[model samples]
Target chain A: AQTVTQSQPEMSVQEAETVTLSCTYDTSESDYYLFWYKQPPSRQMILVIRQEAYKQQNATENRFSVNFQKAAKSFSLKISDSQLGDAAMYFCAYRNSRTFGNKLVFGAGTILRVKS
Target chain B: NAGVTQTPKFRVLKTGQSMTLLCAQDMNHEYMYWYRQDPGMGLRLIHYSVGEGTTAKGEVPDGYNVSRLKKQNFLLGLESAAPSQTSVYFCASEGTGQETQYFGPGTRLLVL
Candidate 1:
């Protein structure tokens, strides 16, 4: 069984500043996928960024990026130039690449507050 | 196009009451999943379907049942509601070749 952990329950960042949310996971599988999802006040889950375990290079999507350290079993999300819209509950997820059914294992979540 | 939609945006049920939540996707996805979200718990999988008529139990399948008679429709049923079952329910679907799952708006369920 894979388990994702988000140590920080709450985080705040100044507008236009950068923020990093920490995430760690325990999985025996060598190949897997890591994802960060954002849930705004609307409560809609949206994909922020994703990283493939096999790729040594981190994944970057516009302002959202991931620092994936496979050896340390750590995958952290970084939001650059943070805006008010970035304020939400962020969740880290994991999925095994070997399985055809892609069931995601998610962390408790971190509440991000972007201050003006 | 509506990616994924869940019927009955909000539902309130009493103990021992029964109800079903419907989920439909228009993306022609082969996999559908049901999950419950609590205050501190991000999301826990309740049930999932790999294909039409093939359903499987997920991490938290107790007190819940799911059916996928049609490829695009997935139904989650609670035979006997309990206070513990009060939580927001979300439906997700993924294509056969896609790794990312698309989520619905979610259904707010309150079991009194």
Candidate 2:
């Protein structure tokens, strides 16, 4: 079984600043995928970014990027030029290979607050 | 496109009552999943379907039943709702391989 852990329960960042959310996982499988999802007050979960375990390079999507250390089993999300709209619950997820398509094991989300 | 949609956005049920939540997707996805989100506890997979008429148990399938009579729709039923079952439910669909999952807006259920 794979377990994802988000140590921070809540985080706050000043507007226009940068913030990093930490995530770690336990998985014995070598081939997998890591993902970051955002859940706003609207209760809609949206994908923010993704990283393939085989790729040594980190994944970046506009202002959202990840620091993936496969050896350490760590995948952290970084948000740059953070805005008020970035305030949401951020989740770190892990998915095994093809046998399970997108069945993600998510961490207890980190509630992000953007302060003006 | 409406993407993924779950019916009855909000519902309140008394203990022992039974209800089914419906999830539908228009993306022609072959895989559908049911998950429950609780405060402090991340999303837990309840059940999933590989395709039409094929339902499989996930991490937490207790007290929950699911059916995918049609490819576009997956229904999750709770027989005898309990207070422990009170949580927000999210339905997701995805294509084969490692494609990203598209999630529904979610259904908020409160068991009294």
Which candidate gets the maximum DockQ versus the true structure?
1
Among these predictions, the greatest TM-score belongs to 1
Candidate 2 off by > 4 Å: none
Model 1, B1-112: lDDT tens per residue? 8999999999999999999999999999999999999999889999999999999999999999999999999999999999999999999999997888999999999999
Clashes by residue pair, model 1: none
Cα lDDT, model 1, residue B100:
87
Interface CA RMSD, all predictions: 0.6, 1.1
Q: For model 2, how does the per-residue alpha-carbon lDDT over B20-54 read when each residue is reduced to its tens digit?
A: 99999998999999999998988999999999999
Candidate 2 lDDT by residue in tens digits, A1-116: 79999999999999999999999999999999999999999989999999999999999999999999999999999999999999999999999875855589999999999999
Global lDDT of model 2: 0.95
Tens digit per residue, CA lDDT, model 1, A23-70: 999999999999999999999999998898999999999999999999
